[model samples]
Target: MNIIGGPAQDGEWPWQIALMWNNIYVCSAALLTPDWAVTTAQCVNQEASGYSILIGTNNLAEWSPNYQRQPVASVYKHPEYNTRIHDFDVALLRLTDPVEITDYSRTICIPTTDMSFEVGTTCYASGWGSSDGINEFLQEAQFSITSSNNCEGVTSNMLCADGIESSGACAGDEGGPLVSLVDTRWYLVGLTSKTTCGSGADVFTRMTAMYEWIAPILDGETPLSK
Candidate 1:
């Protein structure tokens, strides 16, 4: 629970999803479209077929078995995703069944081709990672906006946030959304990719860089967001 302000208050921009595996592999993911979900490839790469997506709820305890357990129909890992160097760690999952879009469930807005955030823009990240800096079963977590320039030493696809060493996403938060407030709505700017572990920076896959790959899928021309 890497909460910055406090435990996630009940109704904050609720487009969150939980990727579950054997009732143990729990990680938060974001719905990018009715048919696609944006999450870290590492989260599902190991057991792609065994995973289930839980949408339309934030409180896991209240989630029911009937709550939309969509099977992952397909997974599109970024061609550049390399675990050794963590180059492009993002991936897209195509649901076996398209989720019904309602007031509580909707696709998040991706940054337009021209829109971007600078080195200093503030952004917020949320997930169900550990709360006490130790890995635990997934729990609600939050963190304040950190800057991007702090990750100059890593791959260009990775961005950084503020915090000395106490803030940022932890394990189990992988594949979650790194949101940026813009124009009165939060835009999907990055996908939680990795954390330095001991460092404060939580690296994310730059969504803008993969706009070309995700465009066809988002536009319905391609079957997957490759």
Candidate 2:
């Protein structure tokens, strides 16, 4: 995915992932753990058998020595997800096998309930999707979290970020991570719901708002886990 403005540094986005369905890039995902990831429900629309997760590399063509590929064991989309409104658009993924979490490959911390981000806090959205189309390298854009009222379509459960003309998600960034650096850790704040390509406001499903549905699953218990 192209950052619209430029490319991401090697290992800069260790938690970024390239998700494929039938060997073709479909969406972006964030590594919450070696065996688990988070994305948008809209992205998990197909069967798990055809899904593939690629990790540990910024450039798809140039495989980083520690790069790994794994199949999806299971997927759980939010029961309340509404496609028309794009509400509650979160999903949890179980990797067939856990990857080795290292400096070159790692997980992004999930935002806790108590952590609060202000309306003007700076955050980032990264993916392999470019403004023109899909690309081989990872790309990122910086945005200041805006208020829900700033956009007519945004709700309290979603976050809005006004994109600078050439700095936002596009064609392939859906289900990717929207993170903010908190102290020394990068906390995943949201999952991309859609891309505005940086011309306007970008949308995301707020992670903290979905914590109740995600907590039990992260604890390894969910009706869909069956």
Candidate 3:
């Protein structure tokens, strides 16, 4: 039943993450707490000392005892986050320990309100990035929520969807995830940040306008400056 953009079915996204860096993988993160995670700050490039975070797995080549890697201890970013114009692209890693959630690892659902989800509202976008590279699994699509005036440097915290051409989420799909099921659960409203895979409109970075900089860094407390 994973249609719209396609390809994803074994365990269907358990908060999909894989941001490794020296072991490769390079981008796509979302497991909110087995030690926090939420990505895109230009994919936190280098220096969290070895970076890591594989977790559960939809096939990073296939291994699964529910995969699970771990190894990054700190890397917040969102002090305005304007890598050029991507504005608040979001970022938060912290996980040198805690990693073993159960039903195949989990955590996702951060939109305590700030609204915005009308235009068309279909949502659901996972990633393992593909343009002919990674992606042996983990890759859902089905976007819809459109009308940031149709993209073109979207703003207003940003959150546009609309996909088509070669599908969507490309180039290692930076900081993946863009969910939205609302009402039945599942809501991590956008994070793939920036795209033009073809049919236009992709931007994202409006997890309820950064929920006051992510609920005190998910309760470890202390976020509220800027």
**What is the Cα-based TM-score of model 2?**
0.93
Error of 1 at 95 (Å): 0.6
Model 3 clash pairs are none
Model 3 regions lying over 4 Å from their true place: 1-3, 9-56, 59-63, 81-86, 92-139, 142-148, 151-153, 156-161, 165-190, 193-202, 205-226
Ranking by TM-score: 2, 1, 3
Q: Estimated TM-score per prediction?
A: 0.83, 0.93, 0.34
How many clashing pairs per prediction, in order?
6, 4, 0
Off by over 4 Å in 1: 64-67, 131-149, 163-165, 196-199, 223-226
Where's the lowest-lDDT run of ten residues in candidate 1?
134-143
Per-residue lDDT over 76-106 for candidate 3, one digit per residue giving the tens place of the 0 to 100 score: 7878888898788888888889878777778
lDDT of candidate 2 over 3-108, digit per residue (tens): 5556888788889888879888889998987788888988986368899888888787777777888899888888888888788888888899997888878999
Instruction: Sort the predicted structures by lDDT, highest score first.
Output: 2, 3, 1
Residue 50 error for model 2, in Å?
0.6
Model 1 per-residue lDDT at 163: 36
What C-alpha lDDT do the candidate models reach, one value each? 0.68, 0.81, 0.78
Q: Tally clashes: model 3.
A: 0
